[model samples]
Target: MITVDFSLFPVGPGDRVLDLGCGGGRHAFEVYRRGADIVAFDQNENDLAEVADMFAAMRAAGEAPAESEAAAETVTGDALDTPFGDDSFDRVIASEIFEHIPHDTAAMAELHRVLRPGGIAAVTVPSWLPERLCWALSEDYHTNEGGHVRIYTRAELEAKLKAAGFLIGPHHHAHALHAPYWWIKCAVGTSNEDHPLASAYHRMLVWDMMKAPKTTRTTERLLNPLIGKSVVVYLRKPHRGSAESTG
Candidate 1:
């Protein structure tokens, strides 16, 4: 499921895109389908292999536009150190990834380094309030292997992006509907797949995603303004000649 809205990122056909830390390749798939030259960059070789296989499968099935063949590639690399030349992609997407990195400033710098002048990057992180609640509700939620290391306030995240050489853009919250499901998971046990309450909530979420029920949809719309689970922020690298500030 997409946490960040693509409209805010505003990519087009022929755009060179990078989905940083592209676990399981959800956002990367979207980029390829839109006729973008996409690289799913991650350190996990196995994950890259899976994403590469899916890319081939999609090409064979014509699941993407006929123009989409080989437009997608997978790169195994550290987030703090992407392998592309400087100013490579027109757009970069780093969703649900910042929290996992300890040196996120360095990672942000790397994202800034790889974007062409004026190219945009979209970032999604766990919203502070909902994430705080999750942490308060369950230790397992943030303490597990590869679990989130920290929750970021929007201001702090925005500041880091700006410091890393990005111009701030419109920001908003998303995935309100999924917040409660996580809260429920924490209330029971983060890994409690068989717990009755968690199971019921999971099914409801599945139905919501597949069926898009009006009741849940409307509720989420209302809740998103209040306590959405994910915070999406758009950023842009300044075009050449833009003034840089130390302030």
Candidate 2:
């Protein structure tokens, strides 16, 4: 499911977009469909391969706009040092990615470097309380090789982004219903696929995502501000004139 709100960080046809750490290419696909030139950047070759295939499929199926100049590609690289030139992308999306990076400051700097002046970025991380519950529930959840390394409070994240030269904007929480499902998984076992309760909860979540019934949508909207599992922060790179003044 998509985590970043497009309304808050709107993109247009031919806008250059980067989906950093694009695991499974969910956000990248959405950007492509919106007619942006999208690069799905990830370290996993297999995941990139799948994302590339999906891009081709979308093109073949005529999912992208005919008059739109959108193009899709995949790039495998380090987040701390992507290969793009400075001021490259018009927009960037980094969802549920920072918590896994050890050198988050460097990665943030890279994100800042690649985005053009006045460009917008949307960053999402695991919210503090729900993530803490997950870590408390299971050692396996955070201890794995690529698992989340830390939970972030909103303040900590905003500070880091500002330090990286981004001007922070309004933020919001998302995916309120996901917190409890993850808590159950962590409590039972991270890999306990056979657990009945966890399986049932997973199925329910899948249904909610696929069908998006009015009741569940309204419930999630009401619950989002209170206990959303992901906190999304929007940031903008200052224009050169404002950059000098802010500096």
Best-performing candidate as measured by TM-score: 2
Tens digits of per-residue lDDT, candidate 1, 149-226, equal 999999999999998888898888888878888999999888889999889988988988899888988988789867
Superposition error at 73 for model 2 (Å): 0.3
* Model 2 Cα lDDT, one tens digit per residue, 8-44: 9898786999999999999998998888889999999
TM-score of 1: 0.94
The clash count of every prediction, one per candidate, is: 0, 0
Q: Where does candidate 2 have its weakest 10-residue lDDT segment? A: 238-247
Error of 2 at 14 (Å): 2.3
What count of clashes does model 2 give? 0
